[model samples]
Target: MQATEPDYKCGVEVTLEVIGGKWKGVILWHLKRKTLRFSQLRRRLPGVTQKMLTQQLRELERDGMVHREVFPEVPPRVEYSLTKTGWEVVPILELMCQWGTARLQGRQEEKEMAQAS
Candidate 1:
């Protein structure tokens, strides 16, 4: 079912707006493994620029989907993990992943069959 204007006016919409960006899904996927440091996240997501990562992390933090912890040390350290609200998004993501995989497989089979004809 498609969401309406009233749906757009609530927390769900705001959460979607934050996570709907290109890199956000990947970021969330990686975080689902375990809490990660900034550099760790960067390594996992190779193509994302440092600036974009910083921006996305800030947005996630602002949206309450990510918890950022700062360490007092010689070099400043930061780590990120999913908040309770963020954890709630995992099942939705998993279902979407399943659908996407099935859709891709279907399209590939169709293409191959068309080529054989």
Candidate 2:
């Protein structure tokens, strides 16, 4: 019988396909907090190059996770914010963070034990 639900492996693969890049997660994290302009995003991520940030934002916007708004004005203002799909990723991001923290804590404890011995 065909399973009604998506295959777990394919599901994970698809999620990673859209967000596997180093900057994507960081970009998503910031967008989740509040809407911000392009310059604001650049300032928030100090190490990210302008080209890279621009590329990442374009990808996210294409994927429907991020919404880009452009205002016709003297300077042509633009802003970015998370869409409904993007907000859904928040809990997933939190889980990833929690897991990383736990892993780091476990590694530190193991290192301390090794040093003591």
Candidate 3:
């Protein structure tokens, strides 16, 4: 279904507003499985600039979709994990993943058929 408003008239738009951005959904996908230290998340998404990742993470935390924990250690360790809402988003993300996989497979088959013809 198509989202009706930029003001988040429905659940889909609200979801997109919360997770919308180049990196937010990707970050959420990674965190869906486990809590990751900042460095670990950085390593996982090597292409993301540190500044951009920091921005996205801060936004997610503000929206309550992600939890940030700080450890009182000599070096000050920090970790990021999905909150309850974030975990609930997992099924939606999974459905998107499945849809993408199917689309890719269809494209591959179409390409092969075109080449054969």
Candidate 4:
């Protein structure tokens, strides 16, 4: 028998459920281009704490949105990249980013108008 998926009707809901955290979208955006080490991810996302980044990465891994690779080297390196499922979100994430920027700009304009009133 085939496994059943979650009861999400809309694709947006399902997508949101997978990447619906503060850091997940940013992490996914970075991973869309190329794989990155843990430290690299942290460096790119300056405001994210080490613990939060680790936790978010782990969650994404569990959700099958990201692939984590651990090397058995002397320094022990770990890298994260997007899975095929994760790659599907690239366009959606871009749209979200555009909408977010537009919303922020609109809010600023509204605030400025209010201040001038």
Candidate 5:
């Protein structure tokens, strides 16, 4: 049997549903540059617990935003990368990063001005 699609009210809602969580967007952002192993991702994201990261990755894979490649080896090697659909979200993530940088800069300038006054 095939899975049913989610009934989203709007595009934004659908966007948020897929990437709104604390770790999902960050995970996607990290995978934007290149494929990474689970350990590499864990190191980049300091605050995320192993269990949570695993859960988030599983969700992303299920959503078709991430591709998990497992290599046959003595132990096993798995790497994660963004899917084509995932690449489509990079521009939005970049815009969000720019907006956040601007906000931080504005706050820092405000702080300096207040200190000088």
Candidate 6:
């Protein structure tokens, strides 16, 4: 029997299901610039456990958003990069960064005004 696809309520829900997590978006953002090895990814993403990063990368790969290539060489170098679909998510992440910066600035201004009063 063929497997059924998930029934998403909307496009937003589908996007969230694929990239809604603390680390997934960040991972994609980091990979937007260039391909990175597993150790490089780990170093770039502080506070993420190796196990969790591995799991997240696996999920991204499975979802077709991330591409992982294994090189046949000493120590078996592995690298991760964003697929075309993954690159599409970059603009959304940029918007999120803008919104977050504005929100934080607004809050800081509010705090400064209150303190001055």
lDDT of 5 by residue, 1-117 (tens): 998988888999999988888999999999998999999999999999999999999999988999999999968999999999999999999998899999999999999999999
Tens digits of per-residue lDDT, candidate 3, 1-117, equal 995646557887888889887789889999998999988999999799999999999999998999999999989999999999899888888998899999999999999999999
Candidate 2 local lDDT, 6-117, one digit each (tens)? 4557678889877778889888989888999999999999999999999999999988899999999989999999999999999989898899999999999999999999
TM-score for all predictions? 0.82, 0.82, 0.89, 0.82, 0.92, 0.91
lDDT of each: 0.87, 0.91, 0.91, 0.94, 0.95, 0.95
Best by TM-score: 5
User: RMSD, model 2, all Cα superposed?
Assistant: 5.6
Kindly report which residue pairs in candidate 5 clash with one another.
none
Model 1: per-residue lDDT, tens digit, 45-88?
Answer: 88999999999999888878889999997798889999997888
Candidate 6 structure quality by residue, lDDT tens digits, 1-117? 999999888999999988999999999989998999999999999999999999999999999999999999998999999999999899999999899999999999999999999
Model 5 accuracy (lDDT, Cα): 0.95
Worst 10 residues of 6 by lDDT: 3-12
lDDT of 6: 0.95
Please estimate how well model 3 matches the true structure, expressed as its whole-model Cα lDDT: 0.91
For candidate 1, the TM-score is 0.82
Give the worst 10-residue stretch by lDDT in candidate 1. 3-12
Please list the Cα RMSD from the true structure of every candidate, rounded to 1 decimal place: 5.6, 5.6, 5.2, 3.1, 1.9, 1.6
Q: Each candidate: how many clashes?
A: 0, 0, 0, 0, 0, 0
